[model samples]
Target: MPTLLETYIENRFRVQPNHANNNETLHGGTLMKWLDEVGAMSAMRFAGETCVTARVNELDFKRPIGIGDTAVVESYVYDAGRTSVHVALRAWREEPRTGEREETTASSFTFVAVDSEGKPTPVPELEVGGAEGERLRDRALSRDR
Candidate 1:
């Protein structure tokens, strides 16, 4: 069983010349690609099998990550079903010089586990073993609001 912290994965991608848009901010499509990749990895870690995007609940780009900044993405499993896992994901912009970071986007995505044959398979029950875990699960559930 992977703990909440163990399920967490953090990665950073430097925005380069080609990673930007005409306006010099990270492109929406590029960000979505990163989100999908990280979200699937988090779900696969929790499910112990390969996973694919089942759905994207919501994606809110509140701000922009500039071209020269590093895009720091983090993901973790917050909810699960018999074959699906809900991952909470966030991306932040980090200024290399000042070491400042701000969240630029957030999203919740669902992934379904698949077997070696690429068929949907059952996933382990998401374990919320204590108060913190319960709180995270509750937070995930409250996203419906």
Candidate 2:
């Protein structure tokens, strides 16, 4: 098994016109698409298999991501259950040229492990070592309550 950090990579994508609403800001649908995709990737790392969204606790679009801004979505495995994984997802917007960044949206999503045939599959026990791991695990667990 690989260290959690080894399996983690921040995903960055631009907020294209097609992803925007008539007002030119990123649509809610677009934000969720990115969140779900990144969250699934995080869960797959811990599950070591394909995963599907089981629930999305909350999706807060605190700020708007406008056109010409790059949307940076960061996701990482934070906690796990017998057959489920929790992921912390954050979206940020940065000016394409100057690199000014600000958080635009945030969400936490849960995913369940699935076998090749798409049935529920058991996942490995989470081994949260070190201070950072402990912190992330605590945060993820807190979200359940």
Which candidate ranks first by TM-score, i.e. highest?
1
| C-alpha lDDT values of all predictions | 0.87, 0.82
Scored against the true structure, residue 55 in model 2 reaches a CA lDDT of: 94
Can you write out model 1's per-residue Cα lDDT over 1-104, one digit (the tens) per residue? Answer: 67665577899999997999999999999999999998888898899999999898999998999989999998889877888888988899999888799989
* Model 2 agreement with the true structure over 1-145: per-residue lDDT tens digits: 4345544558878888988999999998988988899889888877889999999978878899998789988887877778888788888998889989998877788899999899999888767767877776676567557
Worst 10 residues of 2 by lDDT: 1-10
Enumerate residue pairs that collide in model 2.
Answer: none
Superposition error at 124 for model 2 (Å): 0.5
Which segments of model 1 are wrong by more than 4 Å? 129-135
The best candidate in terms of lDDT: 1
